[model samples]
Target: MKKRLSAAISSVGLILGTSLFSPAGAQEIDLYVDTVTKQVYTEPGKNRVKMGTFQQVQKGANRQDKKSSDRQAQKKTDQPAQKDSVQQARKDSSQQAQNEPGPAFVHEPLPERPKEEHWYDRMHIRGYTQFRNSTTVSGDKDAVVYWPDRSVGEDTSFLIRRARLILYGDITDNLYLYFQPDFASTPSGSTTGNFGQLRDAYADISFDDKKEFRVRLGQSKIPFSFENMQSSQNRLALDRADGINTCCRDERDIGAFFYWVPAEIRERFRELVANNLKGSGDYGVFAFGVYNGQGANRVELNNDMHMVARVTYPYQFSNGQIFEAGVEALHGRFVTSNGPVNGITPVMVAPAKGFVDERVAVHAVLYPQPFGLQAEWNWGRGPQLNGVQRLITESPLTGGYVQATYKYDSGPWGILFPFVKWQYYEGGQKFERNAPKNLVNDWELGVEWQVTKAIELTAVYHMMNRTDVLNAPYERFRADAVRFQVQWNY
Candidate 1:
C-alpha cells in the first residue's frame, strides 16, 4: 500500500513540474490532486476533472519557484558583464583614434586649383619715340644734306623720326617670339598711310642649353653691318653713313638666319646689348642668312635670293673697355628699269638683265671709356647709269666712315657724349630707280645728353659735299645743316 502511495505522489509531482516549467499556451489545462479522493484532477476552462492523486503538490510548486528565482539572478549578473564588454570596445576605439598620426576627424576636401595662364599672356612690351627738328645752316634751300629720306625742305622742319612699339616673349622653353611696329613709316602702296607697319616679326628656335645657338626665321635685321644692325635708338650719330646704308636699305628683310655664340661670352654679349653698343644679342661670333634681295617692304623682282654673312669677335680689356672687330659680305641681284633699244629711233626693248650686285665689308669698334673710336669700310660692284647717257653699266665702288667720341657720366646731368664723324662714299645705289652713282663726303659733330633714363636730347652740326648721278641738272651739290632731337624711351 505504501509503495502505491509513494508512486502516486511522485507521478503527481512530475505532472505538476511539467505543467509549470513547460511552455504555456492559451488553452493549457491546470492539473490538480484531490487529497480526500486520493486522485488527480484537471481544471480546464474553469471545469475541474480528476487526473491523479499526490501527497506533495505544494513541495513541487515551491521547488519550481526557487529555480525561477535563481534563473532571474543569473540573468541579472550576466547583463552587467555584457555592458562592461561593450564599454571596453568603445574605449578601445577612442584610444586607437588618439594614437593615430593625422587628425581625429577628416577635413573637408581641398578646393580645386586655378587654371594656369598661357605663355602669350606673359608677353612684355616696350617702345621709344624720336621728335626731331633740323635747319640748313650753310647750304641752299633745296640742299638736303643728312637723312635725305627726312630732309628739311624749308630750311627747318619738325619730324617724327621713329615711333616704335616692341612686343616680345618666350613662347616655350625652346622657342621665343619678337615683334615691332613703326608708326612713323612713310606711306607707300605696301602699307597704310603712316598708321603703322611691321618692322620685326620673327621667332627664335634655340638648340643649346644656354641658347648659344639659334635659328631665326621671318623678317628681321640682316647680319651684315654693325652700324646697320645697331638699333637707331641707340646710335650716337644722327644718321647712319651712306656707305653702310646702301648695303641694306632699312637693314631688314624676309629671311632665315642662324646665330651662334659661345656660352662663356654670353654675359659679355648681353652687356654690350644692354649698353646699346652694336651687340646683336647673343648672336655669337658667327651669323649668316639668306633673304629676298629687293630689301624690306619690297617684293622680290627676280627669282634670285640674297645671301649675307658676318664674322665678329668682341674682346673686353681689364680696364672695362670693349673692342669688337667683324667682317661681312652680301651677294644679290638688283632690278632696274628697261630702256629703249634704239636710242633715237624711239623703239622700246625688254628690261635690262638684273644687276649682279655684291659687296664685302670690314668693321671695328672701340667702346667709349670717356674716349673711343669706330671705323668701317666696304667695296662693291653693281650697275651704274652713265652721268649723261643714262645707260646701265657695271662699276666698282668703295666707301666707309670713321667716328670718335667721348662719354661723360655726369651725376645729375645724366650721360653726356660728344662725337665727331667723317664719312665718304662712292657707290652705285642699285635699289634706286636708275641705279644712281653716289659720291658723298660728309662731316658731323654731335652731343647726346641723356636727361633721364627715359629721356634724351641731341644737338648735331653737319657739313657735306655730294654728287647725285640720277639728278641730271644738279648732279653735284654741297650742303650743311644743324639738327636737334628729343627721344623718349620706355
Candidate 2:
C-alpha cells in the first residue's frame, strides 16, 4: 500500500509539472486534497482539507529572462560604437562613389551646359570722331592749296574732319569682316555737307586656322604706301605727305588682295597696335592684289584692272626696337574729269580714254620708341595740266617726306608726341577737277596729347608753298597755318 501511494504521488507531480509548470507565465499554484476520497482539488469544499501550496519552478524561463536582460544591457553598451561604425561605412561608400563611375543601374544624368552666343552677337561696333579748326597764321590766305583735310585751308571754319563708325567681327574660325562708314564726307560740287560714305567694306577669308594666309575682298585700302595704310586716327601727322597721298586719293579702291605672314609675326603685328605703337596694322609681310583703276567712290571707267604688289617686314632688334621697310608698285590707267574754266563752265580736258597712271614707292619706319623716324618717296607719271599749252598731258612726277618724332609718357597726365616733318612734291593732283600740276614744299611741327584712352588733342603749325589746284590760270602761292584737332574714340 505504501509503495502504491508513493508511486501515485510521483505520477501526480509529473503530470502537474508537465501541464502547468511549462505554461508561458505560470509560477505557483494552490490546491486542496480530499483526505476521505484521496482526490486532488483546486478549491476547498465538502470533505476537502488543505494540502499545501505548490511552486512551479520554471528553470528554463528564469534562465531565458536573465539572458534577455544581459543581452539588452550589452546592446545599450555597444550602441554608440555601432552607430559610429555605420556612419564610417556610409562615409567610405560616398567617397568611393565620387572616385569611380556610378553603377549602370544608377541612371544619373549629368546637367547640360548652356549654348554659346552667336557670331553676330559677338560683333563689335567701334569708331572715332575728329573735329578740327584751322586758320592762316601767316602768308597769302587767298592762295589756293590742296589740303587732304579740306578743313585746313583758309576761310574754313570748324569742321568735322572724320566721323567714322566701324563694325567688325570674326564670323567663323576662318573668316572675318570689317565695315566702316564716314559721316563727314563732302560730295564733289555739292554744297550740302556731312554726307555719309563707305570707307571700308571687306572680308578676310583665311586659308588656315592661324590666319597666316588670307585673302581680303571688297572695297579696301590699297597696299601702296605705308603712311596710306596707317589709319588717319593713328597717324601722328595731321595730313599725309602729298608725295604718297597723290598716288591714290583716299588710299582705297575695290580690290581682291592676298596676304601672307608667319603666324608668330602676325601676333607681333597685333601687339604693336595693341600697345599704342604707331603701327600700320597688318597689311601683310607680302601682299598682291588687283583693283579697279578708278579711285574710291569713283565708277570704274575701263575694263582693265590695276595690278599691285608690296613686300614689307618689321624687324625687332635685341634692344626691343622695331623697324620696318617696304617697297610697293602699282600699274594702272587713270581717267580725269574736267573742271569749270575759271570757275565758270566745265570742259573735256582729258582724253576720251585715260592716261598712264603708275608709280613705285619705298618707305622706312623706325617706330617711336621714345625716338622715331619715317620717310617715303614715290615716282610716277600721271595726267598733268601743261601751264603753257593750257592742255593736260601725262607728266613725270616725284615727291616724298621725312619726319621725326619723340614720344613722352607723362604718367597719369597722359602721353605726348612731338613731331616735325618736311615734304616736297611735284606731281599732278589727278583727283582734282583739272588734274592740276602741283609744286609743294612744306614744313609741319605738331604735338599730340593723349589725354585718355578716349580723348586726344593735337596742335600743328605749318609752313606751305604749293600751286593752287582750283585756279585754272596755274597760280602758285605760299601759306602758313595753325591747326587744332580734338578726337574722341569709342
Candidate 3:
C-alpha cells in the first residue's frame, strides 16, 4: 500500500512538472517597426515589450492520464485541440489589450513645449546705411567738352556718388514704413550738384502680425527685373545688376504692390531673409496712376495710367530641389515724338510709336541646393529717334541679364554666397545702334557675407565685356567698379 501511494504521488508530481514547463507556459513572438521596418524587439530587462497585434503563438496543454489506457488515449487525441485552444486564448487577450489603453506612460511626455518665441515683444528696427565712391569712366565727357579730348581722360574719374540711409521699423503691429533716402548726384559729367532723392517711402500693412499677406505703397521697387529690383542695400555686387534697372539709373518707383503667399509654400522657401517672399515689386493695375511712367530717375510723367503685373509658379522635385518662374507685363504712355527735332522716327521700332509705352518681360529659374540661376528679358517702347526726321519717336529698347550663384551654407565664417552675373541692355535711341542684333553682355563677380542675422555685408566688382561696336556707348566694354554695403536689423 505504501509503494502504491508513493507511485501515485510521483505520477502527480511528474504531470505538474510537465505542465509548468510546457510550450504553452512560454511562447516566442516577432515584431517590427512600421516605417523603419526594423525588427521590433524588447530589451531583456525592459518591464514589458511593446508588441502590436501581430503575433503567432503555438502552445499545447499537458496530457493528464486517467486510470484507463483508453482515457489516456482520449487525452492524447485532445492534444491538437487543446493546443489550438491555448493559442486562441492568447489571441483573445491581445485583442482585448488593443481595445484598452496600455499600462501607464506608454509614450513619454514630449520634452516640455519649447518656449514660444515672443513675437509681440519683438519690434525689429533694422535697416542699412552706406557711403559709396563712384568713378565714371565717362559720364561727364560730353558734358563740358565741345569735342572729345582724347588726352584729357575727362570721362574717367571717381567721386562720392551715393550716400544711402535706410530706416525700417515695426511701428506697432500692423503698420510699418521703409524710408530710404539717397544723397547722390555729385554730377561729374556736365554738371556737379549735390541732391538728395527718396529711394523708398513705403507703408507696409499685413493681414496678420506675421506678415503672411502684405501690401506696400509709396516709392518702392518695381517688380520688373530681378537685378533691376533687387534692393541695392542687399546686393552682393557693385554698381548695378547691369540691366535697365541699374544701367538706366532707375532703381525705385513710387507705387503699390500686394503680396500673396501660401503657408505651405512659405515653409519650403530657403528663408535666407525674413521677408524673402515679399516682392518689392509686383504686378498690378493703375501702376501709373500714382507715379510717373519713367523709373525713379525720370522726373517726367506720361499721359496714360501705367499698369504692371506678375505671376509666379513654384514646383518641388523629389531630389529635394525647388524651382520657380514668373511672367510680367506693363503699359504706359510717354512722349515718343522727340529729338532736337520732332517726327515719328522710332529707331528700335515697336508697334505703337510716338504715343503709348508698352513693356513685356518673362523670367524663369531652377533653384537647386546651393545653386541658383536667373535670367530675364524686357522689351518696350520709349523715346525714339526718327531716322527719317532726325527726331526722337517711340523707339523700342530691350534689356536682359543672366546670373548664377553658388553658396556654402555651412562654413566657419557663416553662410557665404558668391555669384557671377552678365547683362545686355539698350534703351536710348542713340544707344540702340550699338546693341548687337542678338545680344550684348555685361559681367560681374562678387561675394556676400551674411555675417549675422542682424547684420549683412557684401563687396562686389563689376565689368562690361562687349564689343565696342555692339555694346551701348554708356555700356562701355571695359570697367571695374567695386561696391560695399552693410545692413543692421534690430
> Highest lDDT, which number?
2
Model 1 regions lying over 4 Å from their true place: 1-115, 145-151, 188-193, 276-280, 338-353, 468-474
Give the higher-lDDT candidate: 1 or 3.
Answer: 1
- Candidate 2's TM-score: 0.76
lDDT of 2 by residue, 194-218 (tens): 9999989999999998899999999
Model 1 lDDT per residue over 1-490, tens place? 4544554465455444444433222123344433333333333211224553322233366675766666466655644653453344334433432343343233457999998989878689999999888877666657453335364446456788889999999888789999999998875324233568888999999996788889999999989877887788888887888888887768889999998888768788788868745354665589988988777878777887888889999898888889999999999777755343224211111134377778999999898866889999999887676656446677788999999988788899798889999999997766665566788898899999989979999998887788654343326677777788899999
lDDT score, candidate 1: 0.72
lDDT of 3 by residue, 173-193 (tens): 788767777676432233644
lDDT of 3 at 113: 78
Can you give the TM-score per candidate against the true fold? Answer: 0.73, 0.76, 0.54
Scored by CA lDDT, what does every candidate get? 0.72, 0.81, 0.50
Candidates in descending lDDT order: 2, 1, 3
Show pairs that collide, candidate 2: none
Better of 1 and 2 by TM-score: 2
